[model samples]
Target chain A: MEYKVQVIVKPLDAIANPEGKAVERALAALSFDRVTKVRAGKVINFTLEADHPEKARSITEEICQKLLVNPVMEYSEIQISQSGN
Target chain B: MDPIIKIVTFPGTNCEYDVLKQLNFLGADAELIWHQESDLGSCSGIVLPGGFAHGDYLRPGAIARFSPIMEQVIKFAESGGPVIGICNGFQVLTECGLLPGALSKNDRMRFICKTVSCVVKTSGSVLTSAAVAGQTLHLPINHGEGNYVCDEETLKYLRENNLAVLTYTEDVNGSVEQIAGISNKAGNVVGLMPHPERATDPLLGSTDGQVLLRSFIEASK
Candidate 1:
Protein backbone atom coordinates (compact mmCIF):
# COMPACT_ATOMS: atom_id res chain seq x y z
CA MET A 1 0.00 0.00 0.00
CA GLU A 2 1.12 3.52 -0.79
CA TYR A 3 1.01 6.29 1.80
CA LYS A 4 1.10 10.01 2.28
CA VAL A 5 3.43 11.40 4.95
CA GLN A 6 3.62 14.88 6.34
CA VAL A 7 6.10 16.45 8.72
CA ILE A 8 6.10 19.85 10.34
CA VAL A 9 8.71 22.01 12.05
CA LYS A 10 7.50 24.74 14.37
CA PRO A 11 8.90 26.91 17.15
CA LEU A 12 7.42 26.79 20.62
CA ASP A 13 6.18 30.35 20.68
CA ALA A 14 5.20 31.52 24.16
CA ILE A 15 2.48 33.93 23.15
CA ALA A 16 1.75 32.81 19.64
CA ASN A 17 -1.05 30.43 20.59
CA PRO A 18 -3.14 32.30 23.09
CA GLU A 19 -6.21 31.75 20.94
CA GLY A 20 -5.68 28.00 20.97
CA LYS A 21 -5.22 28.01 24.70
CA ALA A 22 -8.44 29.96 25.16
CA VAL A 23 -10.32 27.46 23.05
CA GLU A 24 -8.83 24.56 24.99
CA ARG A 25 -9.93 26.16 28.24
CA ALA A 26 -13.43 26.58 26.85
CA LEU A 27 -13.52 22.88 25.85
CA ALA A 28 -12.61 21.81 29.39
CA ALA A 29 -15.13 24.20 30.91
CA LEU A 30 -17.97 22.90 28.76
CA SER A 31 -17.18 19.33 29.96
CA PHE A 32 -17.77 17.86 26.47
CA ASP A 33 -14.07 17.12 25.87
CA ARG A 34 -11.54 14.42 26.69
CA VAL A 35 -8.81 16.54 25.15
CA THR A 36 -5.71 16.81 27.30
CA LYS A 37 -3.06 18.62 25.24
CA VAL A 38 -3.07 20.98 22.34
CA ARG A 39 -0.36 22.68 20.34
CA ALA A 40 -0.52 24.79 17.21
CA GLY A 41 1.54 23.03 14.53
CA LYS A 42 2.18 23.40 10.84
CA VAL A 43 0.99 20.71 8.46
CA ILE A 44 3.11 19.44 5.55
CA ASN A 45 0.96 17.47 3.13
CA PHE A 46 2.57 15.23 0.53
CA THR A 47 2.18 11.90 -1.20
CA LEU A 48 4.73 9.14 -0.97
CA GLU A 49 5.08 6.47 -3.64
CA ALA A 50 6.61 3.32 -2.28
CA ASP A 51 6.49 -0.47 -2.78
CA HIS A 52 4.91 -1.59 0.50
CA PRO A 53 3.86 -0.40 3.96
CA GLU A 54 7.18 -1.33 5.53
CA LYS A 55 9.06 0.42 2.75
CA ALA A 56 6.71 3.37 3.07
CA ARG A 57 7.25 3.77 6.82
CA SER A 58 11.03 3.48 6.56
CA ILE A 59 11.08 5.93 3.73
CA THR A 60 8.95 8.31 5.72
CA GLU A 61 11.26 8.03 8.70
CA GLU A 62 14.31 8.63 6.53
CA ILE A 63 12.76 11.64 4.93
CA CYS A 64 11.78 13.06 8.31
CA GLN A 65 15.29 12.65 9.66
CA LYS A 66 16.87 14.02 6.49
CA LEU A 67 14.78 16.75 4.83
CA LEU A 68 11.12 16.70 5.80
CA VAL A 69 11.59 18.02 9.35
CA ASN A 70 13.88 19.81 11.73
CA PRO A 71 14.12 17.50 14.71
CA VAL A 72 15.06 20.29 17.07
CA MET A 73 11.66 21.76 17.91
CA GLU A 74 9.46 19.72 15.63
CA TYR A 75 8.06 16.22 16.02
CA SER A 76 6.70 14.21 13.12
CA GLU A 77 3.94 11.64 12.78
CA ILE A 78 3.50 9.46 9.71
CA GLN A 79 0.12 8.40 8.37
CA ILE A 80 -0.16 5.57 5.93
CA SER A 81 -3.19 4.61 3.86
CA GLN A 82 -3.84 3.16 0.47
CA SER A 83 -3.31 6.01 -1.92
CA GLY A 84 -2.27 4.39 -5.19
CA ASN A 85 -0.66 1.23 -6.48
CA MET B 1 51.71 30.13 26.71
CA ASP B 2 50.24 27.80 24.09
CA PRO B 3 50.32 29.81 20.89
CA ILE B 4 47.74 28.33 18.53
CA ILE B 5 44.11 27.45 19.33
CA LYS B 6 42.67 24.74 17.11
CA ILE B 7 39.60 25.87 15.22
CA VAL B 8 37.42 23.07 13.83
CA THR B 9 36.36 23.70 10.23
CA PHE B 10 33.63 21.34 9.16
CA PRO B 11 32.94 20.90 5.50
CA GLY B 12 30.82 23.79 4.23
CA THR B 13 31.64 25.91 7.26
CA ASN B 14 32.85 29.32 6.07
CA CYS B 15 33.68 31.35 9.15
CA GLU B 16 37.11 29.95 10.05
CA TYR B 17 38.87 32.97 8.59
CA ASP B 18 37.08 35.49 10.76
CA VAL B 19 37.89 33.46 13.85
CA LEU B 20 41.49 32.99 12.78
CA LYS B 21 41.88 36.69 12.09
CA GLN B 22 40.35 37.64 15.38
CA LEU B 23 42.60 35.30 17.33
CA ASN B 24 45.64 36.40 15.37
CA PHE B 25 44.78 40.02 16.12
CA LEU B 26 44.77 39.12 19.79
CA GLY B 27 48.27 37.70 19.28
CA ALA B 28 47.04 34.15 19.88
CA ASP B 29 47.97 31.55 17.30
CA ALA B 30 44.98 29.93 15.58
CA GLU B 31 44.71 27.28 12.89
CA LEU B 32 41.85 25.79 10.90
CA ILE B 33 41.48 22.06 11.49
CA TRP B 34 39.64 20.02 8.88
CA HIS B 35 36.42 18.20 9.75
CA GLN B 36 37.57 15.02 8.06
CA GLU B 37 40.79 14.94 10.07
CA SER B 38 41.01 13.17 13.40
CA ASP B 39 44.06 14.96 14.66
CA LEU B 40 43.50 17.83 17.08
CA GLY B 41 46.72 19.74 17.55
CA SER B 42 48.29 20.07 20.99
CA CYS B 43 46.53 23.41 21.44
CA SER B 44 44.92 24.05 24.78
CA GLY B 45 41.76 25.61 23.35
CA ILE B 46 39.31 24.86 20.53
CA VAL B 47 36.98 27.19 18.65
CA LEU B 48 34.11 25.92 16.52
CA PRO B 49 33.58 28.79 14.11
CA GLY B 50 30.21 29.75 12.70
CA GLY B 51 28.97 28.91 9.20
CA PHE B 52 26.82 26.43 7.26
CA ALA B 53 28.40 23.14 8.15
CA HIS B 54 27.48 20.24 5.88
CA GLY B 55 25.16 22.64 4.11
CA ASP B 56 23.22 22.54 7.38
CA TYR B 57 21.30 19.76 5.62
CA LEU B 58 20.12 17.35 8.30
CA ARG B 59 18.92 19.91 10.79
CA PRO B 60 21.24 22.81 11.69
CA GLY B 61 24.03 20.83 13.27
CA ALA B 62 22.73 17.29 13.14
CA ILE B 63 25.00 16.00 10.42
CA ALA B 64 28.06 17.98 11.38
CA ARG B 65 27.88 16.74 14.93
CA PHE B 66 28.93 13.29 13.75
CA SER B 67 31.88 14.50 11.71
CA PRO B 68 35.33 13.00 12.31
CA ILE B 69 36.73 16.11 13.96
CA MET B 70 33.76 16.12 16.31
CA GLU B 71 35.01 12.90 17.84
CA GLN B 72 38.28 14.61 18.56
CA VAL B 73 36.48 17.70 19.73
CA ILE B 74 34.42 15.66 22.18
CA LYS B 75 37.57 14.10 23.60
CA PHE B 76 39.13 17.53 23.98
CA ALA B 77 36.15 18.79 25.90
CA GLU B 78 36.12 15.63 27.97
CA SER B 79 39.64 16.37 29.09
CA GLY B 80 38.34 19.70 30.46
CA GLY B 81 39.84 21.74 27.67
CA PRO B 82 38.19 25.03 26.83
CA VAL B 83 35.93 24.72 23.78
CA ILE B 84 33.89 27.52 22.29
CA GLY B 85 31.23 27.12 19.60
CA ILE B 86 29.85 30.18 17.84
CA CYS B 87 26.57 30.30 15.86
CA ASN B 88 26.23 27.12 13.83
CA GLY B 89 28.90 25.69 16.04
CA PHE B 90 26.49 26.11 18.91
CA GLN B 91 23.95 23.97 17.12
CA VAL B 92 26.56 21.31 16.54
CA LEU B 93 27.59 21.29 20.17
CA THR B 94 24.02 20.92 21.29
CA GLU B 95 23.30 18.18 18.79
CA CYS B 96 26.45 16.40 19.87
CA GLY B 97 25.17 16.47 23.45
CA LEU B 98 28.10 18.56 24.60
CA LEU B 99 25.52 21.17 25.59
CA PRO B 100 21.85 21.08 26.45
CA GLY B 101 18.76 22.30 24.58
CA ALA B 102 18.48 23.00 20.88
CA LEU B 103 18.38 25.93 18.48
CA SER B 104 15.40 25.74 16.18
CA LYS B 105 14.14 27.97 13.38
CA ASN B 106 13.80 31.58 14.30
CA ASP B 107 10.41 32.38 15.71
CA ARG B 108 9.49 34.33 12.61
CA MET B 109 11.04 31.65 10.39
CA ARG B 110 13.56 34.18 9.16
CA PHE B 111 17.32 34.31 8.86
CA ILE B 112 17.99 37.30 11.08
CA CYS B 113 21.25 39.13 10.38
CA LYS B 114 22.01 42.28 12.29
CA THR B 115 24.06 43.66 15.15
CA VAL B 116 22.04 43.28 18.33
CA SER B 117 22.96 44.12 21.87
CA CYS B 118 23.62 41.25 24.27
CA VAL B 119 24.26 41.15 28.00
CA VAL B 120 26.72 38.86 29.67
CA LYS B 121 25.16 36.83 32.48
CA THR B 122 27.67 34.18 33.42
CA SER B 123 30.98 35.55 34.64
CA GLY B 124 33.40 32.67 35.10
CA SER B 125 33.02 30.98 31.68
CA VAL B 126 36.01 30.78 29.43
CA LEU B 127 34.03 32.96 27.01
CA THR B 128 32.67 35.53 29.44
CA SER B 129 35.31 36.36 32.06
CA ALA B 130 35.55 40.06 31.26
CA ALA B 131 31.85 40.40 30.43
CA VAL B 132 29.95 41.10 33.63
CA ALA B 133 26.21 40.93 34.01
CA GLY B 134 24.38 43.66 32.05
CA GLN B 135 27.50 44.52 30.06
CA THR B 136 26.06 45.36 26.67
CA LEU B 137 27.97 44.30 23.59
CA HIS B 138 26.97 44.44 19.95
CA LEU B 139 27.21 41.26 17.91
CA PRO B 140 25.87 40.06 14.57
CA ILE B 141 23.58 37.01 14.36
CA ASN B 142 22.86 35.42 10.97
CA HIS B 143 21.11 32.12 11.25
CA GLY B 144 17.69 30.64 10.62
CA GLU B 145 17.92 28.08 13.42
CA GLY B 146 19.01 30.44 16.19
CA ASN B 147 16.04 30.30 18.53
CA TYR B 148 17.05 28.55 21.73
CA VAL B 149 14.65 26.09 23.36
CA CYS B 150 14.89 24.08 26.57
CA ASP B 151 12.50 22.75 29.17
CA GLU B 152 11.79 24.99 32.15
CA GLU B 153 13.32 22.64 34.69
CA THR B 154 16.50 22.21 32.66
CA LEU B 155 16.71 25.96 32.18
CA LYS B 156 16.49 26.40 35.93
CA TYR B 157 19.39 24.04 36.46
CA LEU B 158 21.36 25.88 33.83
CA ARG B 159 20.71 29.16 35.58
CA GLU B 160 21.57 27.76 38.99
CA ASN B 161 24.85 26.47 37.60
CA ASN B 162 25.72 29.74 35.88
CA LEU B 163 25.65 28.00 32.48
CA ALA B 164 23.44 30.47 30.69
CA VAL B 165 26.07 32.83 29.33
CA LEU B 166 24.43 35.57 27.25
CA THR B 167 20.98 36.99 26.73
CA TYR B 168 19.81 39.31 23.98
CA THR B 169 18.99 42.83 25.05
CA GLU B 170 16.22 42.78 22.45
CA ASP B 171 14.21 39.84 21.23
CA VAL B 172 15.90 38.77 18.01
CA ASN B 173 14.90 35.14 18.19
CA GLY B 174 12.45 33.15 20.29
CA SER B 175 14.97 31.82 22.75
CA VAL B 176 13.67 30.61 26.07
CA GLU B 177 14.68 32.88 28.94
CA GLN B 178 16.22 35.07 26.24
CA ILE B 179 19.20 32.76 26.38
CA ALA B 180 21.74 33.58 23.70
CA GLY B 181 24.43 31.25 25.01
CA ILE B 182 25.01 28.34 27.37
CA SER B 183 27.83 26.26 28.78
CA ASN B 184 28.16 22.61 29.64
CA LYS B 185 27.57 21.42 33.18
CA ALA B 186 31.30 21.28 33.70
CA GLY B 187 31.54 24.87 32.40
CA ASN B 188 34.29 24.06 29.93
CA VAL B 189 32.10 24.00 26.82
CA VAL B 190 30.57 27.28 25.62
CA GLY B 191 27.97 27.64 22.89
CA LEU B 192 26.60 30.89 21.55
CA MET B 193 24.42 31.93 18.63
CA PRO B 194 25.85 35.36 17.84
CA HIS B 195 28.99 35.85 15.79
CA PRO B 196 31.40 37.44 18.22
CA GLU B 197 34.28 37.31 15.73
CA ARG B 198 32.27 39.64 13.52
CA ALA B 199 32.34 42.27 16.25
CA THR B 200 36.00 41.95 17.16
CA ASP B 201 36.92 45.16 15.32
CA PRO B 202 35.91 48.77 15.86
CA LEU B 203 35.60 49.25 12.09
CA LEU B 204 32.73 46.76 12.15
CA GLY B 205 30.97 48.55 15.02
CA SER B 206 32.44 47.36 18.28
CA THR B 207 35.52 45.60 19.60
CA ASP B 208 33.51 44.19 22.49
CA GLY B 209 33.91 40.70 21.08
CA GLN B 210 37.60 40.84 21.88
CA VAL B 211 36.93 40.33 25.55
CA LEU B 212 35.31 36.97 24.93
CA LEU B 213 38.34 35.84 23.01
CA ARG B 214 40.53 37.37 25.64
CA SER B 215 38.76 35.29 28.25
CA PHE B 216 39.41 32.16 26.24
CA ILE B 217 43.04 33.22 25.98
CA GLU B 218 43.42 33.67 29.70
CA ALA B 219 41.39 30.60 30.65
CA SER B 220 43.34 28.37 28.30
CA LYS B 221 46.53 29.38 30.02
Candidate 2:
Protein backbone atom coordinates (compact mmCIF):
# COMPACT_ATOMS: atom_id res chain seq x y z
CA MET A 1 0.00 0.00 0.00
CA GLU A 2 1.10 3.54 -0.60
CA TYR A 3 0.88 5.98 2.31
CA LYS A 4 1.10 9.71 2.43
CA VAL A 5 3.09 11.07 5.34
CA GLN A 6 3.09 14.60 6.63
CA VAL A 7 5.56 15.53 9.34
CA ILE A 8 5.09 18.71 11.32
CA VAL A 9 8.29 19.90 12.97
CA LYS A 10 8.41 22.65 15.55
CA PRO A 11 10.94 23.95 17.96
CA LEU A 12 10.42 22.54 21.42
CA ASP A 13 8.53 24.87 23.74
CA ALA A 14 11.60 25.37 25.88
CA ILE A 15 13.49 26.60 22.86
CA ALA A 16 13.13 30.17 21.75
CA ASN A 17 11.25 30.63 18.51
CA PRO A 18 12.79 33.74 17.04
CA GLU A 19 10.93 33.55 13.75
CA GLY A 20 7.64 33.15 15.57
CA LYS A 21 8.38 36.10 17.78
CA ALA A 22 9.29 38.16 14.75
CA VAL A 23 6.05 37.23 13.10
CA GLU A 24 4.13 38.08 16.22
CA ARG A 25 5.73 41.51 16.33
CA ALA A 26 4.89 42.06 12.69
CA LEU A 27 1.29 41.11 13.37
CA ALA A 28 1.08 43.53 16.26
CA ALA A 29 2.45 46.29 14.07
CA LEU A 30 -0.19 45.43 11.51
CA SER A 31 -2.90 45.99 14.21
CA PHE A 32 -3.52 42.34 15.07
CA ASP A 33 -2.83 42.92 18.75
CA ARG A 34 -5.10 40.13 20.04
CA VAL A 35 -2.51 37.49 19.16
CA THR A 36 -0.69 36.37 22.27
CA LYS A 37 1.84 33.95 20.80
CA VAL A 38 2.95 32.49 17.56
CA ARG A 39 5.21 29.48 17.02
CA ALA A 40 6.80 28.80 13.69
CA GLY A 41 7.29 25.33 12.26
CA LYS A 42 7.69 23.36 9.04
CA VAL A 43 5.68 20.64 7.41
CA ILE A 44 7.31 17.89 5.36
CA ASN A 45 5.15 15.70 3.12
CA PHE A 46 6.17 12.49 1.42
CA THR A 47 4.76 9.23 0.03
CA LEU A 48 5.95 5.78 1.03
CA GLU A 49 5.10 2.15 0.41
CA ALA A 50 4.34 0.01 3.43
CA ASP A 51 2.68 -3.29 4.23
CA HIS A 52 0.14 -1.80 6.60
CA PRO A 53 -0.88 1.44 8.26
CA GLU A 54 0.92 0.50 11.45
CA LYS A 55 4.06 -0.18 9.49
CA ALA A 56 3.69 3.13 7.71
CA ARG A 57 3.25 4.97 10.98
CA SER A 58 6.34 3.30 12.44
CA ILE A 59 8.32 4.08 9.34
CA THR A 60 7.25 7.71 9.39
CA GLU A 61 8.10 7.97 13.06
CA GLU A 62 11.51 6.48 12.43
CA ILE A 63 12.13 8.92 9.62
CA CYS A 64 11.11 11.77 11.89
CA GLN A 65 13.46 10.57 14.61
CA LYS A 66 16.38 10.02 12.29
CA LEU A 67 16.21 12.78 9.70
CA LEU A 68 13.17 15.06 9.82
CA VAL A 69 13.58 16.23 13.39
CA ASN A 70 16.50 17.19 15.59
CA PRO A 71 15.39 15.80 18.94
CA VAL A 72 17.61 18.28 20.74
CA MET A 73 15.66 21.34 19.65
CA GLU A 74 12.69 20.23 17.60
CA TYR A 75 9.78 17.82 18.00
CA SER A 76 7.69 16.25 15.27
CA GLU A 77 4.17 14.91 14.77
CA ILE A 78 3.67 12.39 12.00
CA GLN A 79 0.44 12.07 10.04
CA ILE A 80 0.11 9.05 7.79
CA SER A 81 -2.79 8.15 5.56
CA GLN A 82 -3.44 5.75 2.73
CA SER A 83 -2.47 7.16 -0.65
CA GLY A 84 -4.62 6.15 -3.58
CA ASN A 85 -2.40 4.57 -6.20
CA MET B 1 54.71 11.87 7.11
CA ASP B 2 52.65 15.02 6.91
CA PRO B 3 49.23 14.46 8.36
CA ILE B 4 46.55 14.28 5.66
CA ILE B 5 43.54 16.37 6.59
CA LYS B 6 40.43 15.66 4.59
CA ILE B 7 38.02 18.59 4.10
CA VAL B 8 34.62 17.17 3.29
CA THR B 9 32.64 19.17 0.77
CA PHE B 10 28.90 18.81 0.27
CA PRO B 11 27.25 19.95 -2.97
CA GLY B 12 26.87 23.57 -1.84
CA THR B 13 29.91 23.84 0.37
CA ASN B 14 32.10 26.83 -0.43
CA CYS B 15 34.78 26.97 2.24
CA GLU B 16 36.70 23.75 1.58
CA TYR B 17 39.32 25.45 -0.54
CA ASP B 18 39.87 28.15 2.04
CA VAL B 19 40.41 25.51 4.68
CA LEU B 20 42.58 23.56 2.26
CA LYS B 21 44.81 26.52 1.46
CA GLN B 22 45.24 27.42 5.08
CA LEU B 23 46.02 23.88 6.19
CA ASN B 24 48.50 23.44 3.37
CA PHE B 25 50.23 26.67 4.30
CA LEU B 26 50.39 25.50 7.89
CA GLY B 27 52.26 22.31 6.92
CA ALA B 28 49.43 19.82 6.52
CA ASP B 29 48.42 17.94 3.39
CA ALA B 30 44.82 19.10 3.16
CA GLU B 31 42.56 17.57 0.50
CA LEU B 32 38.94 17.96 -0.50
CA ILE B 33 36.67 14.93 -0.28
CA TRP B 34 33.26 14.90 -1.90
CA HIS B 35 30.19 14.08 0.19
CA GLN B 36 29.34 10.94 -1.80
CA GLU B 37 32.61 9.12 -1.04
CA SER B 38 32.03 6.47 1.58
CA ASP B 39 35.62 6.15 2.71
CA LEU B 40 37.95 8.71 4.17
CA GLY B 41 41.01 6.71 2.99
CA SER B 42 43.54 7.01 5.81
CA CYS B 43 42.88 10.58 6.77
CA SER B 44 44.56 11.90 9.88
CA GLY B 45 41.84 14.48 10.42
CA ILE B 46 38.49 15.51 8.98
CA VAL B 47 37.01 18.99 8.47
CA LEU B 48 33.51 20.01 7.45
CA PRO B 49 34.01 23.51 6.16
CA GLY B 50 31.42 26.29 6.06
CA GLY B 51 28.83 26.86 3.32
CA PHE B 52 25.13 26.51 2.48
CA ALA B 53 25.21 22.75 2.21
CA HIS B 54 22.28 21.48 0.14
CA GLY B 55 21.35 25.14 -0.02
CA ASP B 56 20.42 25.00 3.66
CA TYR B 57 17.25 23.17 2.69
CA LEU B 58 15.12 21.50 5.35
CA ARG B 59 17.24 23.39 7.84
CA PRO B 60 20.98 23.81 7.66
CA GLY B 61 22.84 20.52 7.67
CA ALA B 62 19.64 18.47 8.03
CA ILE B 63 19.98 17.06 4.50
CA ALA B 64 23.77 16.99 4.47
CA ARG B 65 23.90 14.88 7.62
CA PHE B 66 22.77 11.92 5.51
CA SER B 67 25.64 12.27 3.03
CA PRO B 68 27.72 9.16 2.44
CA ILE B 69 30.88 10.77 3.84
CA MET B 70 29.26 11.42 7.22
CA GLU B 71 29.44 7.71 8.07
CA GLN B 72 33.21 7.74 7.87
CA VAL B 73 33.35 11.08 9.62
CA ILE B 74 31.38 9.60 12.51
CA LYS B 75 33.67 6.58 12.67
CA PHE B 76 36.78 8.72 12.54
CA ALA B 77 35.44 10.88 15.32
CA GLU B 78 34.59 7.84 17.42
CA SER B 79 38.16 6.59 17.06
CA GLY B 80 39.35 9.92 18.49
CA GLY B 81 40.54 11.36 15.19
CA PRO B 82 40.34 15.13 15.08
CA VAL B 83 37.24 16.56 13.38
CA ILE B 84 36.24 20.19 13.24
CA GLY B 85 33.07 21.62 11.72
CA ILE B 86 32.97 25.33 11.02
CA CYS B 87 29.78 27.33 10.39
CA ASN B 88 27.39 25.23 8.31
CA GLY B 89 29.60 22.26 9.02
CA PHE B 90 28.97 22.86 12.70
CA GLN B 91 25.24 22.73 12.04
CA VAL B 92 25.72 19.34 10.36
CA LEU B 93 27.60 17.93 13.34
CA THR B 94 24.78 18.85 15.68
CA GLU B 95 22.24 17.41 13.25
CA CYS B 96 24.20 14.15 13.09
CA GLY B 97 24.36 14.03 16.91
CA LEU B 98 28.13 14.30 16.99
CA LEU B 99 27.65 17.44 19.02
CA PRO B 100 24.94 18.53 21.39
CA GLY B 101 22.55 21.45 20.85
CA ALA B 102 21.27 23.03 17.64
CA LEU B 103 21.91 26.24 15.82
CA SER B 104 18.65 28.07 15.26
CA LYS B 105 17.72 31.32 13.60
CA ASN B 106 19.43 34.30 15.11
CA ASP B 107 17.35 35.95 17.76
CA ARG B 108 16.89 38.99 15.57
CA MET B 109 16.26 36.77 12.56
CA ARG B 110 19.00 38.30 10.46
CA PHE B 111 22.04 36.82 8.79
CA ILE B 112 25.16 38.10 10.50
CA CYS B 113 28.52 38.58 8.83
CA LYS B 114 31.27 40.13 10.87
CA THR B 115 34.37 39.55 12.93
CA VAL B 116 33.62 38.95 16.58
CA SER B 117 35.79 38.40 19.59
CA CYS B 118 35.64 34.97 21.13
CA VAL B 119 37.04 33.79 24.41
CA VAL B 120 38.65 30.38 24.59
CA LYS B 121 36.78 28.73 27.43
CA THR B 122 38.62 25.42 27.22
CA SER B 123 41.82 24.18 25.64
CA GLY B 124 40.92 20.51 25.91
CA SER B 125 39.39 19.99 22.44
CA VAL B 126 41.13 19.45 19.11
CA LEU B 127 40.26 22.96 17.96
CA THR B 128 41.57 24.68 21.07
CA SER B 129 44.49 22.51 22.14
CA ALA B 130 46.99 25.22 21.24
CA ALA B 131 45.28 27.97 23.20
CA VAL B 132 44.74 28.56 26.86
CA ALA B 133 41.58 29.26 28.78
CA GLY B 134 40.62 32.96 28.86
CA GLN B 135 42.60 33.67 25.71
CA THR B 136 40.61 35.74 23.21
CA LEU B 137 40.60 35.40 19.44
CA HIS B 138 38.88 37.36 16.69
CA LEU B 139 37.10 35.29 14.05
CA PRO B 140 34.50 35.93 11.42
CA ILE B 141 30.95 34.60 11.73
CA ASN B 142 28.51 34.48 8.82
CA HIS B 143 25.21 32.75 9.23
CA GLY B 144 21.53 33.34 9.71
CA GLU B 145 20.93 30.41 12.03
CA GLY B 146 23.91 30.79 14.31
CA ASN B 147 21.94 31.11 17.52
CA TYR B 148 22.62 27.88 19.42
CA VAL B 149 20.04 26.27 21.70
CA CYS B 150 19.83 23.14 23.84
CA ASP B 151 17.94 21.66 26.75
CA GLU B 152 18.82 22.59 30.30
CA GLU B 153 20.25 19.17 31.07
CA THR B 154 22.58 19.22 28.09
CA LEU B 155 23.66 22.76 28.86
CA LYS B 156 24.51 21.76 32.40
CA TYR B 157 26.46 18.76 31.20
CA LEU B 158 28.38 20.82 28.70
CA ARG B 159 29.23 23.28 31.45
CA GLU B 160 30.28 20.58 33.92
CA ASN B 161 32.49 18.87 31.34
CA ASN B 162 34.02 22.06 29.94
CA LEU B 163 32.89 20.98 26.48
CA ALA B 164 31.92 24.52 25.56
CA VAL B 165 35.16 25.44 23.81
CA LEU B 166 34.65 28.96 22.56
CA THR B 167 32.21 31.65 23.66
CA TYR B 168 31.47 35.02 22.25
CA THR B 169 32.78 37.85 24.40
CA GLU B 170 29.37 39.40 23.89
CA ASP B 171 25.97 37.97 22.98
CA VAL B 172 26.61 37.98 19.26
CA ASN B 173 24.01 35.47 18.15
CA GLY B 174 22.05 34.80 21.34
CA SER B 175 23.69 31.41 21.79
CA VAL B 176 23.24 29.85 25.16
CA GLU B 177 25.87 31.34 27.46
CA GLN B 178 27.15 33.08 24.37
CA ILE B 179 28.69 29.80 23.27
CA ALA B 180 30.23 30.10 19.83
CA GLY B 181 31.61 26.57 19.72
CA ILE B 182 31.58 23.28 21.58
CA SER B 183 33.24 19.86 21.56
CA ASN B 184 31.95 16.35 21.99
CA LYS B 185 32.50 14.58 25.29
CA ALA B 186 35.63 12.89 23.92
CA GLY B 187 36.90 16.22 22.56
CA ASN B 188 37.79 14.75 19.15
CA VAL B 189 34.79 16.33 17.45
CA VAL B 190 34.30 20.09 17.64
CA GLY B 191 31.80 22.48 16.06
CA LEU B 192 31.65 26.26 15.87
CA MET B 193 29.78 28.92 13.93
CA PRO B 194 32.83 31.10 13.36
CA HIS B 195 34.86 30.79 10.17
CA PRO B 196 38.42 30.12 11.28
CA GLU B 197 39.62 29.44 7.74
CA ARG B 198 38.52 32.86 6.56
CA ALA B 199 40.48 34.50 9.33
CA THR B 200 43.81 32.75 8.72
CA ASP B 201 45.44 35.59 6.81
CA PRO B 202 46.78 38.89 8.08
CA LEU B 203 45.35 40.50 4.98
CA LEU B 204 41.90 39.34 6.03
CA GLY B 205 42.11 41.49 9.20
CA SER B 206 42.99 38.75 11.66
CA THR B 207 45.35 35.78 11.81
CA ASP B 208 44.04 34.64 15.17
CA GLY B 209 42.22 31.75 13.50
CA GLN B 210 45.64 30.24 12.82
CA VAL B 211 45.85 29.45 16.50
CA LEU B 212 42.77 27.22 16.34
CA LEU B 213 43.67 25.65 12.97
CA ARG B 214 47.21 25.03 14.18
CA SER B 215 45.78 23.32 17.22
CA PHE B 216 43.69 21.13 14.91
CA ILE B 217 46.74 20.26 12.79
CA GLU B 218 48.74 19.31 15.85
CA ALA B 219 45.91 17.11 17.05
CA SER B 220 45.76 15.48 13.63
CA LYS B 221 49.43 14.60 13.89
Question: Best candidate per DockQ, number?
Answer: 2
Task: Please provide, for model 1 over A19-43, each residue's C-alpha lDDT reduced to its tens digit, 9 standing for 90 to 100.
Answer: 3555677888999488755556566
Candidate 1 segments exceeding 4 Å error: A1-72, A78-85, B1-3
- Candidate 1 lDDT, B1-221, residue by residue in tens: 44468999988889999999988888887788899988886777999999899998747788898788889899989989999999989998988889988887676545788888999987768899867876888888888878888777778889789888889987888888888999987778999998889888779988888888899877777
- Which lDDT values do the candidates have, in the order given? 0.81, 0.92
Estimate the TM-score of every prediction.
0.77, 0.95
Q: What is candidate 2's lDDT per residue for B93-113, written digit by digit as tens?
A: 999989988998888778899
lDDT for position B71 in model 1:
90
DockQ of all candidate complexes: 0.15, 0.72
Cα lDDT of candidate 1 equals 0.81
Sliding window of 10 residues with minimal summed lDDT for model 1 chain B: B102-111
List chain A TM-scores, every candidate, in order. 0.57, 0.95
The runs of at least 3 residues in candidate 2 whose Cα sits more than 4 Å from the true structure, single-residue gaps closed, are B1-3
Among these predictions, the greatest TM-score belongs to 2
**CAPRI level of candidate 1:** incorrect
